[model samples]
Target: MKIDWKNKLTSRKFISAVTGVTIAVLAIFNVDNLTTEKVTALVSAIGLLAAYIVGEGYVDANRDK
Candidate 1:
């Protein structure tokens, strides 16, 4: 019953799904195109950074093993 949140957070599929859902919600609210684009870019950047950080942490953890 436990969720592997680390894997989820680092998953490209999961990140893309989140970005899609965010865009959908923005569209539903009739957000301006510029604002939506900005939000999307920010989300994508954050997702990439998060994945990189997690991946590096995993590598560092296993480096001495």
Candidate 2:
């Protein structure tokens, strides 16, 4: 079976889940709060950028249809 990776990558839930998991792993390793926060922010920013890029690509692809 094939997976729709584009849809998964653009999903808010998937992004949130990834962020949550990242934070949890950091906490498990006793990472400092400041570093954890920074990591979380970076992950969120990257996720947003990825979602925006993928969404725009999809729109552009269908614009001429």
TM-score of each: 0.92, 0.92
Candidate 2 yields a Cα-based lDDT of: 0.96
Q: Lowest lDDT 10-mer window, candidate 1?
A: 9-18
Candidate 2 per-residue C-alpha lDDT over 1-65 given as tens digits, one digit per residue, 9 for 90 to 100: 99999899879999999999999999999999999999999999999999999999999999989
lDDT digits (tens) for residues 1-65 of candidate 1: 99999999879998899899999999999999999999999998899899999999999999989
Model 2 root mean square deviation, Cα atoms: 1.0
Report the Cα RMSD per candidate: 1.0, 1.0
Off by over 4 Å in 1: none
